[model samples]
Target: MATVVLPRSLVALFPGAEHRVEVGEVGSVSGAIDALEARWPGLRDRLVEAGPSIREYINVFVDGEPAALTTPVPPRATVHVLPAVAGG
Candidate 1:
């Protein structure tokens, strides 16, 4: 399992989850969403989308770099997902 840190907003989505993980390279963000959907079928409809652009309000990182929206993530890694809120 990967150790994931999520912003407060997203934390609500993963109720009772202490950490987060996807199926690894065989999967991607889509996979994570898939897995979550499998468990809570209503989840995918809320968390994922497909269009000309992904939502700009989010910033998902893996090992501190921006994560691939479609790239596969490995298990046993660290990931962070947060809203793109910033200010001077």
Candidate 2:
């Protein structure tokens, strides 16, 4: 199982959302998101867009490295989902 760390802002939108969740047997980032979606409805839509790509305002990282939907997720790895930040 991979451990997914969700941003607080995102978790706040979903009641009972946890900061960390364990998803079973996910081979890629997309699979991890699907697993999260199964647990928390509408989660995928928040993170993914119509093209099934990561939302423009969102960023996903695996094991401390930038990642995409198809990025491989090794067993027991950690995935982080965050909202992109901008400054003037």
Candidate 3:
């Protein structure tokens, strides 16, 4: 199982917004997100677009390295999902 870490922004949608979850048998970043969505409905939509691709303003990281939706997720990897922040 991979450990998925969600940002505080998205966590608000959930009851506890605990911000962390463990997903099983995920092969890629998208799969990790799928697992999260399965547990928390509507979560995936907040990160993906019509292409089922990661949204432009959203960033994903695997073990501290920037990654894309297709990025392979090795077993027990840690996936981090964060929304981009901008300020002037």
Clashes of 1: 0
Candidate 3: give the clashing pairs.
Answer: none
Question: Could you give candidate 3's per-residue lDDT for residues 1-88 as a string of tens digits?
Answer: 7899998878988766568888977999999888888888888889999976899999999999999889999998999898898889
- Residue runs of model 1 more than 4 Å from their true location after superposition: 13-26, 86-88
Runs with alpha carbons beyond 4 Å of true place in candidate 2: none
Cα shift from native, residue 57, model 2 (Å): 0.7
* Candidate achieving the largest TM-score: 2
The per-model lDDT (C-alpha) reads 0.58, 0.95, 0.88
Q: What is the lDDT of residue 84 in candidate 2?
A: 97
Query: Which ten-residue region of model 1 has the weakest summed lDDT?
Result: 17-26
Best of the candidates, lDDT: 2
The CA-based lDDT of model 1 is what?
0.58
- Which sequence of candidate numbers ranks them by lDDT, best first? 2, 3, 1
Off by over 4 Å in 3: none
Count the clashes in each prediction: 0, 0, 0
